[model samples]
Target: KKDIEYLSLKNLTVELSNLVFLLEQQKLKGLILDYVDLKDNGDYSMEYNMRLNLEYIHFANVEMNFFRWRDFFKFADFGKIILEFDRLLLQENVLSYIGLLNSYKNVLYLEIKFCNLYILRDFHKILNKFKYLQTLKLNRYNDDRNSSLYMFEAIKNMNYLENLTINLPYRGVYNNSDYFFGMQNFKVLCLTGTNLTQEIPNIKIWGNYTLLRTYIINKAIIKVYDLIEILKIESLTKLSFLDCDIEPCFNYISVELSGIKIKSLDFTATNLDVLKNFDIFKEFARLETLHLSNCNLKSGWLTQTNQSCNLSLKILHYAANCFDRNDLNRMNNLEVLEELNLRDCKFYSCGFFELGNDCKFLGSLKYLDLLHVEINIEDLIFLKSFKNLKNLNLTLSDADFFTAKNLLFYLPINALSLKECNKKSIFENSYSRYLYEENINLNLNSLSSKSFILIRI
Candidate 1:
């Protein structure tokens, strides 16, 4: 009976381990362990046994008892492993404890955040010996000026690497030193919190494997010219700039074609006037989706200029701006446009009337978003003219004038989202009122329902 209980407990522990793995799987890659306390877990023997059984492991805020170092080292020799030690109170003695797992060559992804600088230096030296390493992400907790440079030098030594992401928390300029030297075959490179005031380092120096498809810059103070130089690379397809002050003519002025076949472009606080000229669009003829948020433009610039380019544009999103009805009318000419998203654009009264009359060419539109626009419910009623609209989003609008009977009249609409509206009392007042009075399903949720549906707040 005791043996049976032991086996049951073992199975329960395995199930718990799998559950923990599943919970962390979504946030981090592969596996993640955050702040596991080892001191109060009684004997250190079971922890070493668990590590031995775990083929893949990720640790964040984990505490280890130094007494089990030998057993843990032996168990780490099995398969893939990832160790993340963030905000650990190592008490100055953690370096020797960490040195035991230095020979783990099969670790595919490794991340170390917020450790003593000296301990990190030793960890860097240990990581250099890993032959099969693919990804290395390091975040320095200290504010030392030369810490990032030191980490860079350590990374340059590792030759057999594919992806590298680094976060430099210090306040200084990152120069081309020993750190940024040896990443010749790196397919993806991401740098955060570094003072990249000048142009991005020339990517041509990184050899021909140019697998850099995605690049993100957050709170960067670099100029538009600097960014244009980086875009000259032919391999980059996705680029995002957040809180960046890029010039309007960055794309127009840069004559060099990076050969970059950009598919999606996201610009926030960046001047898009660089794309005002039709020549830039010709270069990016393959662009499928364009996202422009918080950008300043002269209302009808995009609609007028985009007519000249041979764009296979399927989706165009412009939010949080002042666009006139004429701009919306001009977009109807884009015959291939499938999805149009215009949010927070304070429209003049009867703006929807203009769209209804002029935007007849947008017959192919499947999805339309007009959230927070100051329009009447009559505009939504007018949208019944569109024969192919599959999804409609009209959240936070003053469109409550349309009664349930009026909504049942529109038959072709598959999905309608009117969240947070001023019409919750109507649902209670009409149980079978819509069925008897209007002859349509009053509480319909399916897309196929041609009845009056209400998704109340």
Candidate 2:
């Protein structure tokens, strides 16, 4: 079933004439209906050969009516509509789904979760009738006290929105961003405000969007000169300071994070734990993929490397911090670090990751996640000389079932993990004597002796 093109009908009571006989026998192109309780005035306008080759339609907690969803979107002949109208119950079926989206004028990606478009009375002129709406998400988790505050000014005629998400809490969004000025093709924006402030500073009136690129800070708490003036927008690359909150002065925004040209930086549970001078990762000369989960750096973050280190880092996640050994040698000078997650850190032993040698420090490490690190057994014995090591995770306290049975014999590990070990029959009798040693054909204890296996040859 993974040859999926997309078909979902959740919480079903499916019946609109067998749901238009399963969208004309599934000649589908993405259709999702959650909490479906179909049958409201069940009228399929003579199925039109079960009209539907839909180009994406997601309706959550659905309710059918507006001419039974305009006869299943006029039996969608597969073109127009990237609609994701979610979890609704708003009556007059959202003004008959905005008069069935004015006959689907090529609807381009519109998301309205937890719906209540202020009862659609010219709701932003009915979302500018999708004049090629690039992508727009609104009212997600719309704090319903019987939903009301809505004031969004119809995004001043979409004018080709590249991507805009407006989470309407206590709602008051009114965009005209100078009608998407300089037509820079806005890249991505998530505007959040309940009672506003922490500084949106009206996103500097969005004029010189200058090709804005990814800025999600949903659930506002923004500031620090309105997020360093929206990361100095010179075609910003990516900044997801998710679930918001910023004002933790990293050297007072280190001279506005030095001429920003952000290249993927997500900091969940933000504030960067009182940021101890990562000198703002030497001002992003193209920082590549850094998702800092649970930031807990006590001064000495990313420990060293400056003189504009041009860090094109390849994925590093310091999950559940307390990561020791100068935080894994401040990622051994990030030499193109290819994926690493020091899970549940703060190693007390196992030679503070001198791991008995061979990890010339993240030498282009091919994914390593040390879940719950309290290492031993010689830090999984020389960490099998990491160089492009495929995937590895350790748990059952990093060895001692006969030193994890020579851990797949001097590790030629394509992917290996030893989960939940507290001598559970010594890892199920050493994974049944390492799968009866079929001449030790290195299937490395075949994954699950209770989870953590990441098969990646």
Candidate 3:
């Protein structure tokens, strides 16, 4: 089967000419048809050396009449198409059946969820026929405010539109921060709104947006003077404040809005407990990724100020925040952190060698999630002092089975998930006699030796 290249077909009743002859005899390049029931076997002839290089096609809750697969997307030859569609039953009127996706006009990447573009008419003439669209996600676009500024003025002249996701938050849809001042050749602009707290239209028209890098603002309200003109745009470098609510007006400003070349700053579930002393991360000194997941952070919510004491943070998520030890020693100034998630946290009364002795970025961590942490085995033997821990998730941990076989016999872990662990002590028999010793190699789910240790239960 040429090692099947991604094909997910949920539910049944296929026959779209036997699902395009099973994606051309299993040469599939990704195809997920959930809740399928396609059936349109009239065999709309196309056999002259028939070719169909599909690059990804997802059709959720799919039934049929997707324009009767428009003659199998007009004699298939799709390449970079990443077309997704949820709640599919398009029958019609979705912008007059969105020109039946112009019969696959290269659709670079397009996601349309829960379809219902409210009162959106002439949606940019059906998105300018996806002129090789470069990523576009639209979900529940409850159009209003001039049909959402004519759908952001027809996707700002598309020109290979570089990522534009509009998930209409709260859905009252009145957005208008000048409907994204002409997108300036957007390089990722996610806007979900409620009020997006208008007003911004100055700051030299957002420094002409200079090919805006990445700017997301979901569940909006933002108004610290429109987040200082969106930190003066200056070619933004990734800035998200999902589930937002800023508005403190930077405490009646008095200077201090430093340089800011934003190097990723997603305040997920953003509330920041009311801008705890604000210090907008001392105005981003090229901050290296900081997501503050589910922010309900305690213990001085980071404020050792000396301008955030030289943060060289290289990824720190802080999932479901519930810290302690002075909030893990104030994230020991993100000592060159190299990825740390802390998923669904709850370590309040300190554990895991007190978070490996008060988080000094857990000794240059190399990816660690700790999903649903309620850890055990002496707090999973303090993750052997994270000597550059190479990927460890522990999905739903409680480590047993001899503490996950003593953490794969002393961690040098190169991927360990343990998803809902203890599946019959993970095939015990003394763990298949330590995987038949020798050079090691046990399957069912990873456990090769001399390195690659992905033991995901």
The local distance difference test score of each candidate is 0.53, 0.58, 0.63
* Global Cα lDDT for candidate 2: 0.58
Pairs that collide, model 1: 33-60, 35-60, 35-61, 152-179, 153-179, 232-258, 233-258, 234-258, 234-259, 248-274
- The residue-by-residue lDDT of candidate 2 on 355-387, one tens digit each, is 324334445678777755665665666566675
**Per-candidate count of clashing residue pairs (backbone under 3 Å):** 10, 2, 0
Best by TM-score: 1
Off by over 4 Å in 3: 1-11, 14-37, 41-96, 100-123, 127-151, 155-228, 231-279, 282-327, 331-429, 432-449, 452-457
Please say which candidate is ahead in lDDT: 1 or 3: 3
Order the numbered candidates by lDDT, best leading: 3, 2, 1
lDDT of 1 by residue, 1-457 (tens): 2221101111112233343333334222233445445433445435534343344555555455566544555564434544544444562345456456546666666655556443444445555555466777655544344645555556666776677766643444244442453355676666555444533443344344367676666545554555656666567777777656554442345456635577766676566665555244445656667777667666765554345222366777777766776776666566666777777665543365466655644467788776656545566566776678776665422235334346634533332334333344446645335323343333544423222334322
Candidate 1 at residue 143, lDDT? 36
Per TM-score, what order, best first?
Answer: 1, 3, 2
RMSD of 3: 15.6
Q: Alpha-carbon error at 105 in model 3, in Å?
A: 25
